[model samples]
Target: MVDGAGSIGGELSPVLEVGKSLAAPIWRQFMYLYNYSTNFKRLEKEVKKLKNTRDEVQHKVIAAQRNVEEIKQNVKDWLTDVEKTITEAEQLIQEKANNPQCFKRLCINYKQNKKAFKLKREGIDPLLQKEKEFDQVSFPTIPQDIWLRSSEDYLAFESRTSMVKNVWDALNDENVYMIGVYGMAGLGKTTLVQEAGRKAEKDNLFEDIVFVEVTQNLDIEKVQTKIVEKLSIKFSNETERANKLYERLRSGKKILLILDNIWEDIDLKTIVIPSKMDRGGCKLMFTTRNLDILEKMGSTNNFQLGVLEEEESWNLFRKMAGDVIQTHELNSLPNDVCKECGGLPIIISTIAKALKNKSHPSDWKVALRELRAPSPTKFMGFLEKEYMKMAFKL
Candidate 1:
């Protein structure tokens, strides 16, 4: 009797183990039906929290941009992950409208409902933690300035490419004190210099770079502030700002200064800009529409950029305007328009983009008329082109 009882007890234990294992999957199957609405509500609430975090971070991003600081990679990564998580969770919510409940059909998909539960723990929670861990949104470094990023690489011609190389080589030349890139307006002077400056910094040619565009209305204080700011220094009163800038440059760091769009000369005495004689590691580069201005600045190496060749101009224009201008009806008119731009990249591109929408021959004639009818604000300010960029889209 005892032996028979032991045998029955052993069989009962395995049967209980089997029953316990089956109960879990059965509960899991019903969980979506029972908790589907609850999980969705929780996920929605979590997403809202995530969005609030994103909003706060976005403000930081804007401030970083305004201050000309680089946004931290981790912060950028977290933001991307948050956006993806919210999108997936929201998609799951939208899918629930036609989805069969977990208990309604034997073969029903629980993936969508399960994601709602999984996302809170898997996606939203991690982002919330990441947000809490962030102490700052940006890091400070001398980044390549505007033109390097915003302008397209049009170093197609060997001439422009050689100019860029010569300029970079000039910076390395020990005897070279101040370098100037001289050309008429819209000749990509700013673009070329900025790219060279970027390469110099990347190759560790310069310890730091400060780039500031000194527009027509030059504010001495504003110029000083911009230079100081790029070096991660605060500009207080004018005297204090100049002193700080001068001292920083005098610190013997190989700092490259690029002053763009200088209409007239700025006094180094007032700004306390140290020369290479004082600090051999420091260098100055400027761009001006007039070669005379470069000469006045005492540029040791003045490089002049020529207008793009006829072929280059058409290629640039076509790239912007597309085949609409290349159609059968508009063959010579396109060439005529390219000639009107006079090999200036800015003019060619702006005219092409503005004319891209206006495929009619009459529209081309109107553009030609505007090009021929000279406006005082046409070249230097690009006022006409600026207007075209906005007007055409309307």
Candidate 2:
């Protein structure tokens, strides 16, 4: 509950003031959230566009492949035809030589046509060489990007732009950057990272993008098989699963792995991080709330997520409320109301939604009073603690 009118206002203003000073480029802070939203919408539009493009490319490549196959078959048939022709020609020449008088007129004509025989041999040799090269060539399959949900309307996340971009750039770098993106519950860390993975895949930054949610109870074998399934590689024997995974991961291609909801420090050796990949760079991105777990994971860097700005928070609250509070009189109290929610987007949105049906000033005051209750952070912390417990069990 938010105490909108009393001591809660005192607490809200100072936190907002301190947060603004602690974070630079205040508006720039929201870049990741805004860019993610924009990119997601663009991707949605391009998905259909790319589908048509892939269909067209597939049709063209298939036609080209078939033509190459047909050429090889034609050469095979021609070779058979030529073999019969050569055998018949040899027999004719032998018979003509043996019976010179019988072949007197024909012998002169056969000698005169030797130039045509040379031309036939020359044409067949080049065609055969071409057929061999065509047989060796294989066309590549068109790549497809996976579709994940967009985060454009997720107003609570509008201020996490820098941290998101840092993670994105780090993942896109040439080294395996193990970066951690952590936040209190419902700050949209998983959603933002997933969207980043989708974007990376679409941009061709990686050959493969994998998403795995690691729960508290760890199963090493299960994780291995899941990765194999995602890559569409087969395992002849379950015993060789780890070996096969190691081999596949080492085969020189950039892979972006998203290990979401990670609570425990994962041993890279057991996961087979493929230290010897022929590919220059690959990445692993993890999301968690526990700082100690991240440190144990040997993170190259860590990002701590904070609450949204007042303006952004209010905007998100308004959007969630929709047409219920259209006029200035109703809207004027939101900043005072929002501040009491401790700048947490989840809390703000939840409260805004609960009061969407109420239009009177007295009702708004009652709602604010509830928010100002002593257990505000604890209320939000309850969900985070449960989720964190579940995430780290692995």
Candidate 3:
């Protein structure tokens, strides 16, 4: 009985040791789960607060976005209203201008007939007052916003407009003091710069805008004279002119100096124009047919003007052709002529002007033939004759 009791006790001892090990791990797992649950309960209030704040912020953003859209719509409506009013006023003025003879007769009759004079006064007084008011309306107070003199045959196209925008943006950048616009001859480089100058002036970007033409021959004296003349400054001594010009430019106000049709590099210092790095607010803009000229002049930014796209070329051609193009019999001929123009504004405008009064399809065909096989001597002779005709008409 003693031996059996010993064997049973030895087996029961190993079972008791295993039970102790399992009990210790179970107690540790229970404590870990208890701590994790406590932490989650503690964070619950903060998580709720964060979600509420997020919702409030989202609502505010939506409200702000709505307000912005409302303001944009209001501004758009205002601009539309102003544009409509201006159009109506312009039409009225044009009508009055067109019937000047009728208005003169009415005025003379009003002087002789008392009853008619009273009725005329009633009918015309308001219009006259409105006309006077329109005239008196202050023109935009832009300083020296002059369109640089150029050939009136210039046409605007998308590519040219995009280049202008790029130049404008570059000029707005404080780092860009000198900008160069280069293109092939007769590609409307002069007109592009002129438009940019006009826009900059209207935007009040500069205090003074001066345009000077620098032909193939760079005449320093002539350029200086023109600039000083535009500034209303006089300096008699040739040597002191540079100093005078520099001082004038340095005198507080920003100046935009446009040099058109440069054929070669120009030393800005020689002409008394401030260099790109010298002046604070003064800016220099020049156009050349050669990109290398811009590099020589130390241009901070340069833009190359390209020809008009086919659609833009066609639109400009049709506008220039005017009533002559309305004849359906001349279909495809006008398009062919425009295509032959090779998107050159000068050629297109000159040809269009020459054909402005003619409606015959044969006349266009003849013009197209000449354009297709233009003889230098013959074209020059034709242009001279046209110029004389235009001069006589003027």
lDDT of 3 by residue, 1-394 (tens): 1121122434534433444366776643433332322322323333344335434434544565554422234333433443444354344434434543243344322222222223223433333333323221222222343464333555657667777789889878877888998877656677777877877777888888898888776889999988888887767787677688888887757888888888889878788877656785788888888899989878859999877788988888888888888888888888898898788665666677777887888888877777777555433434445534432111
When 2 and 3 are scored with TM-score, the better candidate is 3
Give the best candidate by lDDT.
1
What TM-score would you give candidate 1 relative to the actual structure?
A: 0.61
Q: What does candidate 1 score in Cα RMSD to the true structure?
A: 11.9
TM-score of each: 0.61, 0.52, 0.58
Residue 185, model 1: Cα distance from true site in angstroms: 2.1
Better of 1 and 2 by TM-score: 1
How far off is residue 276 in model 2, in Å? 8.0
Residue 119 CA error for candidate 3 (Å)?
38
Question: Over the stretch 148-209, how does candidate 1's per-residue lDDT look in tens digits?
Answer: 45446445565477777788789899678799988876676776777787677678888888
Backbone clashes in candidate 2 total 13
Q: Which ten residues in a row have the lowest lDDT in candidate 1?
A: 1-10
| CA lDDT scores, all candidates in order | 0.75, 0.59, 0.63
**Candidate 2 residue lDDT tens string, 72-148:** 35534544554554454445445444644323353333331332233234533343344445332334343343335
List candidate 2 segments past 4 Å from native.
Answer: 1-149, 154-159, 275-281, 327-337, 346-394
